[model samples]
Target chain A: MDVDICGPSIPTILGIASEQVHASSTGWSPIYVQDNFGVMSVGFMLPSSRDAIMWRGPKKNGLISQFLKDVDWGDLDYLLIDTPPGTSDEHLSIVQYLKESGIDGAVVITTPQEVALQDVRREIDFCRKVGIRVLGIVENMSGFVCPNCKNESQIFKPSTGGAKRLAEETGLEFLGAVPLDPRIGKSADFGVSFLDEYPDSPATTAYLDIIDRIKQLVD
Target chain B: MDVDICGPSIPTILGIASEQVHASSTGWSPIYVQDNFGVMSVGFMLPSSRDAIMWRGPKKNGLISQFLKDVDWGDLDYLLIDTPPGTSDEHLSIVQYLKESGIDGAVVITTPQEVALQDVRREIDFCRKVGIRVLGIVENMSGFVCPNCKNESQIFKPSTGGAKRLAEETGLEFLGAVPLDPRIGKSADFGVSFLDEYPDSPATTAYLDIIDRIKQLVD
Candidate 1:
């Protein structure tokens, strides 16, 4: 479930912002997408796409609890919760709510730059302190491949060894790196999966490889 | 004062993270910088540059309130508080604490893209709802200039008329646009001012023009 309450971009990313969420007897029902992936976000409840969620701590925590307890999410293989950037309130709320549910582990995604890695380090520490087993680290936007020339460039220069180095430092597993593809952004804007659109892209290959690693770890 | 509690980038941006915050009888004193600017951020309290603040809402609100009330900020002409993205707890807390200070409105900074403009729209609405007057809007990363070729490219693509258009739609003043210069990022990374480094750059000129506009609005 997409729980980034403040700026829930999942519906927009999936091109289902127009889809209305229903109120079931149990709680709120999520919008079902392809592959039986049920999605619930504040975006679904917002009056308009441009509306901002000006909520305080209590309100946010309450909504998060509701999303967890109220949402009628049935049996699923995996339920990925996308959070906003930071190791803040949302993370705490999610961990607290899902404590008994056996939240498999967290897959921390980060860019290669030190500025981003600094936060990721803190995220790792947070998980450790909170007793959430970190599954692995995934370095996104690792490198950029030019469309015409196919030449690789470090737009967001991985100057500090990226996620692999971070994994090594923290003794966590390093999943893989997803190169920067222009089509990825376009795909997100168009409400389509870049993996499906550009099957042959390096990012897709990296994703598949990472998924394999995750399966091995989980299994 | 940079109010972004989770990830305070001001100290890093200004290259003053190493400076220790002083505890005074009145309150905590801010670091004095050039141009008589008194800077205070959560970054100063951090143990290391790479450290992350994994705080929830209550802690964040407490720190923000402390920054506002406890900081021994003497009389100042202007006190710019750089907040993190979104109009959530931080914004609300700041507004609540500084309600009697006669806040001189806000200068909404955004990039030249619908994706960014969408958030800016929400921000404008937030200001209106809270009764915080918006000074104007500044469109950043409007265009990119190739260092080698000197050819300007709309990397961010101001396709939707960006901030100016949004200002027009919302009946707010369109301050100006700051072009995407590689030096700007480098300056930020190096903890220096881009305006000081690239005095003649288009961005610097634009900043000057925007400042003039702001002066007209305020003075």
Candidate 2:
């Protein structure tokens, strides 16, 4: 379920923004995606697309708790949560609520820039402080390929050697690097996955490789 | 001073991450930048570059209060705060603390994409709900220019007509649009303003125009 309450982009990203959430006798049911992936976001509850969620920390916590406890998430092997970028209230609330559910740890995402890495380092520290395992780091937007010339450009120059170097320093496993594919944004806007749309794209390969690593880690 | 506690990007953007905050008789002093712009961010107080701030709402509120009350701001013409994306705890805390100070209003920023505009509309609503004036909307990353071909590309594609259309729909003043410049990021990394570095850039001209409008509004 997508728990990034403030900016719940999952519905939009997955092209299921039109889908509505329905309440059952027990709790709220998530919008089903593909075969087995059921997704839920505060975006579904918004009045309009232009509406903003101007809520405080306690209110945010309340919504998060509802998503966790009130959602009838049937039997599932994985319930991946796309959290907002930070180790703030949302992270605390989620960890606290799911203390007994045995969360598999956090898979932090970051770009190859030092500015981004600096923030991500804190995320790893947060996981450790909260007794959550550090799954690994996935470097996104690592490089961009020019549509015209097909030449690769490091727009966000990896001054600090990207996440691999970070993994080495922090003793965390280096998952992989996902290059900047313009198609990725397009795919999100169109409500599809880059992997499904561009099956042969390098990003798709990278994602598959990352999934393999995750499977091994979980197993 | 940038009050976005969880993800304070000001220090990195200004290329002044190395500067440290010092305590004075009155309170904590802000890091002075070029042209007498005093800056303060939680990023300055971090132990290391990689250290993450895993704080909750109360702690964040405490820090925000300290930044406002304990900081030796002295007298200034403008004390612009670059808040994090969303109208959450930070926004509430800042507005609450600065209630007596007569905050001019909020100058909302967004890109020309439905995805971004959707969130910004809520921000405007937040300002209205909290009695904070809606200064206007500034569209950032409206377009990008290719260095090789020098052809402008609407990378984010203003599918929803961006802030101008948003302003038109909401009956609010449309500020202006700032084109996406690669140099902007580079300048931030190098600790300089794109306006100073690339004075001839379109972005610089747009910034000047925005400043003129802001002067007219505030004065």
Best by TM-score: 2
Question: Residue A152: error of model 2 in Å?
Answer: 2.8
DockQ, every prediction: 0.45, 0.56
The ten-residue window of minimal lDDT in model 1 chain A covers A144-153
Q: Whole-model lDDT, candidate 2? A: 0.83
* TM-score: model 2 vs. ground truth: 0.93
Give per-residue lDDT, candidate 2, residue B63: 93
Best by DockQ: 2
B71-177 per-residue lDDT for model 2 (tens digits): 99988889898898887888889999999988998888997777777778788888888898887889987776667666555666676687899999988888898
Residue-pair clashes per candidate, as listed?
0, 2
Query: Candidate 1's residue-wise lDDT over A1-219, tens digit each?
Result: 776777677886787878889998978988987768889988888888777789977788899898888888887777788988777888888998999887788999998766677778878888887889999999987765444454555555555677899999899999999886556655665577878888987889999999999888777
Candidate 1 achieves a global lDDT of 0.81
Task: Look at candidate 1 and tell me the lDDT of residue A186.
Answer: 54
Task: Give TM-scores for every candidate, taking all chains together and pairing residue i with residue i.
Answer: 0.91, 0.93
